[model samples]
Target: MTFRLSVERLVRIFPAQGGAAEPTRAVDGVDFVATAGEITALVGPSGCGKSTLLAMIAGLEPCDSGAVRAGAVTVTALSAEKSALWRRAHVGFLFQDAGLVDRMRVIDNVMLPMIYRNAKPRDRRAAAIAALERLGLGNMIERRVDGLSGGERRRVGFARILADPRPLLICDEPSAGLDADNTEEIRKLLQIARADGACIILATHDPELVTVADKVLPMRRGQLVAPDLALRAGAQQAAAAS
Candidate 1:
C-alpha cells in the first residue's frame, strides 16, 4: 500500500540538563504532511529537534503527546515489538554515523535488515549485492566496514536502505562530513530514491543538500518557524558556541 506520512501536533519533552530549570520540548507541536514520492527536508542546526522528530515518526522514540500516522497505521500507538515490525516493513532510517557494524563485511551489514524481515538468505544476498553495486560499492562488499573511509561507510549504509526499498525513508544528516564529490554522490542517491516513489524526509544543515528537497521545513528551538528566523537563530547559536 502507498503511504503518506502525517504528523499531528507531535510533542516530545526531555528533562532539563545542566543548569536548566524547565523541561526541554524536544519536538514542540510539530505538524506536517510529507507525501509519497516527494522529498521533505528539515533544515536546522544542532539540537533543533530534527533528529528527535524523525525518530518519533519512525516509532523509534516515544511521543510525550500527539499522534503520528503513516497512512492507516497510528505510529504513536504501537508497542515496542509492533513498532519494530512496523519499521522493518515500512521505514528505512539512515542515521548520521551510518550505523554499520564496524567489524562485519559490507555485504553482511547491508543484509542485516533483511535478515530481521526474514527474507530468504540467497534472495537477500542478491538484493544486497545489487544495492551495493547501484551505489558504486560492489567492489567493497567483501571489505570489513571498519576498514572503509567515511564516504564508503555512508555509501554502504545507503546500500542497506536500498536493499529492501521501504516506502518511507528517513535520513539524519546523510551528508554530515564528506568531501564535495561524496556529498554530490549522496544527492544523486537521494534523487534516485525519490524517483522510486519513496517518501523521503531528511534532517540536514547542508544548504546544498536542501536544494534537492521538494519542501524545506526550517526548524528552530524544536518548532517549525520562519526561514529567516531559523537561519538567524542558527547563526547566533554558532557564534555563541565559538
Candidate 2:
C-alpha cells in the first residue's frame, strides 16, 4: 500500500530547563505510516507528546533524528523556505484552538490559505464559499469569526482546511471544544476527506475520535502503542465464531 505520509524512526527532543541538562525526548523513535484515504488517530493523555509529533509531521517543528516523508518528498532535509512551500501546497493544519482571525469574516478566514498561495481572488472566493457550504456554514460566511460560537468557529476552521484541498491534513484536537452534535459533524467531515483520498492524522485525547480511526495510536511518555490492533483482532475472532 502506498503511504501518503510516513515517519521512520523519528525522534524529537526539546531543550531542558535552564539550558544546561540533556534535552528531553518529546517523541522517542516513533514510526508510523498513514495510507491515503485513511484516518489515523493519535490519542494520549495531556503532555504525552501527541501534539509534538503532529507538529513535526506538519513541518512546524524539526526532528532530532530519522526522516519524515510526505508522499515522494523527504521533509527532514528541506530548507525552511522549501518546507513552507511544501506545506502550502500539500499540507493543511487545524489547530486545537479554532485559530481563526477574529477580526476577519468567516469566509475571509476560510480563504486565507488560498490567498497566501496567491490564488486568483475570484477563484479563491468561490472555493471558500463552496467549502463553507460543504461544512454547513454557508449562512455564517459574512459574520465576523469572533461573533460565532465555539462550534461555528471550529466549522470555519474545518472549512478553511477543506478549501485548501491539501492531500495531507493534520489536525490537533479538532473536537476539543465541540459538543456531541458538533463533534459528530466534524467526524463526518473527516470521513469525507478520507474518502476523497486525503490522509488525515488527528491528535486527540477523546476516545470518541478513536472509534472512527483506521488505526488508533496511544501515546504514553512519548512512545506510541497500537491498541487498535488487538481490539480489532479480538473482534474478528468473535465474529468468526458467531
Candidate 3:
C-alpha cells in the first residue's frame, strides 16, 4: 500500500541549556508533503534542523506545534507509550548512526524490528534473510559482525528497514561512510523501494544522491531555504571549482 506523509507548520523548540536565555528551535514551522514513489532529500549543512524534522516525522520525538499525517494516521499526536507500535505500523527508519546491535549476527539484527512487533519467529527469520540478500549481504548473515567494515555494518543496519512491512521509509545519512560502489548500491536500492510505491524522505549531503531526488528541500537554521537560489549557488561554485 502507498503512503503519503504531510507535515504542516511543525514546530519543536528546545529549552536553553547551560544558562543560555534563548531556547534552540530545532524545527521551526516546517511544512512539506512526501508522497509515495518519490524521494524527498532534505539537503543542508550538519547543524541544520533536518534530522530534527525527520525525528518528528518518524514519531520518535514530539513537536511543540503542527501535525504529521501519514495515510489516515496523525503521527505527531501519538502518545509516547504507543510510539513503538505506531512506528512499526507505518514507518521504517534507518538511523543516522547505523543503529544495529554490535553483538548480534546480521540476520538477528535485521529481524529485531519484527520481533519488537511480535512477529512469529519463522516469518521474521524468512523476512530477515530476504532483506539481507536484497542488500547484498546474504552470505554475511551468519558471519560475526567483527568481520565487516563500517560501510558493510551500515548495510546490515539498513537490512532492518526491508524486514519491516512499512510504507514510509525514513533514512538519515543513508550513504555516509560508504565506498563508491556501496553508495551506488544504496541509491539503486532507494530507487527500487520508490518503484515499489514507498514514500522515502532522507537527509543527505551527497551531490550524486541529491541529483536523484524528485524534490530537494534545502534547510538552514531551522527553516526551509529557497531551492532555486541554493541550486544556482551550487552551480556557480561547481563552475568555479572546475
> Which candidate achieves the best TM-score against the true structure?
1
Clashes of each: 0, 0, 0
Error of 2 at 171 (Å): 1.0
Better of 1 and 3 by TM-score: 1
lDDT of 1 by residue, 78-196 (tens): 99999999999999999888989999999999999999989999999999999899878889889999999887888889889989999999998888777788788889989998999
Which sections of candidate 1 miss by over 4 Å?
232-242
lDDT of 3 by residue, 1-242 (tens): 45788999999999999999999988889989989999999998787798899989999988999999988888888888676688887788898878877788888889988888889999999999988888889889998676788888889878889777578899998888998887888898899888988899999998878877899999877888798877776788689999
**Models ranked on TM-score:** 1, 3, 2
lDDT on C-alpha atoms for all candidate structures: 0.91, 0.86, 0.86
lDDT of 2 by residue, 1-242 (tens): 45478899989888887866777788998998988899999887677788889888988899899889987899887999999999999889997787899999999999999998999999999999998998788888999999898878888898899887788999889887788877887889899889898899999877777788998888766787667754665477689989
Candidate 3: stretches off by over 4 Å: 19-21, 144-147, 231-242
Clashing pairs in 3: none
All candidates: CA RMSD in angstroms? Answer: 2.1, 5.9, 2.8
lDDT score of model 1?
A: 0.91
